[model samples]
Target: MAVNGRSRVPTRRDLAEEELMLDTYRGRRYCKQHPSQQMIPLGVADVCPLEHSAAGEQPVDQ
Candidate 1:
């Protein structure tokens, strides 16, 4: 079981983080433009940066 009874299904970001051996917060993806910032995954959902800002909180129950 995952937090709030949600499944821990791995997103693209999660896989990318695992591939990079990064321990970033859940739902956060790597940012190529701003290496320091981890934004939400978008586009093909392939874990690439779409924006260069901090990844806002995921939608409720997302």
Candidate 2:
């Protein structure tokens, strides 16, 4: 989740995370901007990637 303010530095893996609104990874199709490009801010959801998927729970959970 997006904190009211910036607190920590984001990693390449964190940025590459696709679901969150603040994902600014270079690998993402939308954020053509470089990861280091500070013009835009970034954030991640508190939820996990599998939880966000329409496929529902992880296959291992069954």
Candidate 3:
């Protein structure tokens, strides 16, 4: 089977392994390191404005 750019033969073991991995994060939103925040599926590099702020800290008014 060709998915994206990778080709692999679908097997019971492969499906099982993929399911197991998905199960580990079935309901997860954010990453393990930032459990309180929402998951940024694409990435966080220069995309999240508050990425550098401390959790729960309010922004300073200009």
Candidate 4:
């Protein structure tokens, strides 16, 4: 399983687990972290982006 443009982030310890991701009709992220033997839509290791800015943090670099 390979993510086209999304790359893995570096970490101190190995995260020997896989997480699945799903999107609704409006393209919303849904986490389905299961270890079943089926096709899954994995997302970036980092947490999802916020809908709006609160404290004017730097925008994420896509």
- Tell me each candidate's TM-score: 0.26, 0.21, 0.30, 0.14
1-62 per-residue lDDT for model 1 (tens digits): 26788888888987876856644444446555555556655554645344434554332221
Q: 1 or 4, which is superior by lDDT?
A: 1
Rate residue 50 of model 3 by lDDT.
Answer: 32
User: Clash number for every model?
Assistant: 0, 0, 0, 0
What tens-digit string does per-residue lDDT give for candidate 4 at 1-62?
33587777745343332221223332443322322223323454434333324544643333
lDDT of 1: 0.54
lDDT of 3 at 37: 56
Give the Cα-based TM-score of candidate 2 against the true structure.
Answer: 0.21
Which candidate leads in TM-score?
A: 3
Better of 3 and 4 by lDDT: 3
Candidate 2 C-alpha error for residue 24, in Å: 14
N/CA/C clash count, model 1: 0
Alpha carbon lDDT of each predicted model? 0.54, 0.39, 0.55, 0.36
The residue ranges of model 1 lying beyond 4 angstroms of the native Cα positions read 22-62
lDDT of 2 by residue, 1-62 (tens): 35567577767777756436444444333222232223332454222222223453423231
lDDT of candidate model 3 versus the reference: 0.55
Clashing pairs in 2: none
